[model samples]
Target chain A: DVKVTQSSRYLVKRTGEKVFLECVQDMDHENMFWYRQDPGLGLRLIYFSYDVKMKEKGDIPEGYSVSREKKERFSLILESASTNQTSMYLCASSPSDSSYEQYFGPGTRLTVT
Target chain B: AQSVTQLDSQVPVFEEAPVELRCNYSSSVSVYLFWYVQYPNQGLQLLLKYLSGSTLVKGINGFEAEFNKSQTSFHLRKPSVHISDTAEYFCAVTEGNSGYSTLTFGKGTMLLVSP
Candidate 1:
């Protein structure tokens, strides 16, 4: 079985604070993704990394950045958190060749006040 | 670009009753379709996927989905549902040609199963 682990299950941060959400996968998948899920808005992609240090912006990448210094770890960074940034953040990973199947980590519910 | 649309935002059903969750997608090229179920406070898990060969794909938990290319739809169905089946179901699509594995998800359909 594939295991994806997130650093935090829940988090709270004040406005204008910096936040980081970490995700690690034991499968050594080459593709990692960050998504924010909201009611009625669905899971919108924030950022994705195909390889170490290689990142690409998704549909909604504003106010968010990603780091993939190693193959097993991917991190989501909020330069300065805002109330609007509060959401259920999800991390997923898949193989480089077979992208159809993705394994997801338990999400982190971030609350910004 | 690939996009997915879940027709119904919510579906209410009783235990041992049949249920169907509709999903539609749009993409110029051949695409891979997937249905995922998210239990309360849990991450999304793959329910089923239509990759190739077969149009009807069966997944875990007695859930199944059919991919209709002509209709551009991949609707999930279950013959008899249980209270444990209550969860948020999301439909997603990824273009076959796109080198990256970026998936476009539909606004999920929340399935509420009652006794």
Candidate 2:
């Protein structure tokens, strides 16, 4: 079975601290994505990586960055954690083609204080 | 650019009642539509998708959605809902025939099924 796993289920960080959220997929997919889910706002894409070392900014990429050193792992980074950044973060993976559905990780709930 | 809109924020219904969750989209070109369900505290799961050919698509858990190109809508419906079906549903769209699978999602609708 295809599976996606996030490094942490919950995290807490102080303002100005740097935070990392990791995601790994066993499906060997070429496309990976990071999104933040907020009440009323839904899930907004933060960043997506199409290949190793290749990344693109999404609609809401202002306060976030991503890294993909390997095909199966994608990481979302917060340079400076802030209260506004507190939300549930989701990671997903799909094959290179657009026809396949994205497989998602359980999610990481981050609390910024 | 493509965008999606989920008409209702929340819908409350009794168990075994029929339910409809509306979704609309705005895109200049052809698009692929999808419905995803997010259970409490978990990740999103694909409920169904409308890629091509058939206007009506059936999905897992006895749910289905119809694609209306002229109306620019893809509404999700189920004949009967169980209490276990309570969750948030999202509508998403991506430009069809594109090399990438990046999607634009709706704000989502919360389905509260009561016994």
Candidate 3:
């Protein structure tokens, strides 16, 4: 079974603070993605890495960046936390091939105050 | 570019009642369709996927979806829903190219099962 794990289940940060949310996958998949899920807006992608040290911006990448130092670990960085940035953060991974079914982590709910 | 639309935002039904969540999409190329379930605070889980062969696809948890190429729709259905089946359902699509496999998701539909 494929397993994706996030660093924290819940996190609270003050405004203007830098925050990092970590994600790790045990399946050795090649594609990793970060998304923020909101109530009505659904899930919007923040960033994704197809390979180590490579990153691509998604639909909503503003004020956020990602790091993929290793294949199994992908990290999401919030340069400066804001109240509007609070949402459920999800991490997912898929195989390098055409199989696009993403395996997701439990998710990290971030709160900015 | 590919886009998905889930028509209903919420669907409330009694236990043992049949239910359907509608999804439509527009894409330039042939597409792959998928339905995912998110329980409360959890992330998305694949319910089913339509790749090529079958128009009717069965998934986990007794859920199924039908792919209609001409209509550009993939609707999910379950015969009898339980309280445990309550969750948010999201429909997603991606270009079916062997090389490209990024997904575009729709605003999800919440299914509330009442006892």
- With a 3 Å backbone cut-off (N, CA, C), the pairs that clash in candidate 3 are none
Q: Could you list the chain B TM-scores for each candidate?
A: 0.96, 0.97, 0.96
Candidate 3 local lDDT, A4-112, one digit each (tens) = 9999999999999999999999998989999999998888988999899999899999999999999999999999999999999999999977768999999999999
> Residue B61: error of model 2 in Å?
0.4
For each candidate, give its TM-score against the true structure: 0.98, 0.98, 0.98
Model 2 vs truth, CA RMSD: 0.9
- Give the candidate number with the greatest lDDT: 2
lDDT of 3 at A61: 95
Docking class for model 3 is medium
Q: List where candidate 1 sits over 4 angstroms from the true fold.
A: none
Question: Tens-digit lDDT track for model 2 on A1-113?
Answer: 78999999999999999999999999889999999999999999999998999999998999899999999999999999999999999999999775758889999999999
Worst 10 residues of 3 chain B by lDDT: B95-104
Q: For residues B39-84, could you state the per-residue lDDT of candidate 3 as single tens digits? A: 9878889999998898999999999999999999999999999999
Give lDDT tens digits, candidate 2, residues B1-115: 7899999999999999999999999999998999999999899999999989999999999999999999999999999999999999999998856455698999999999999
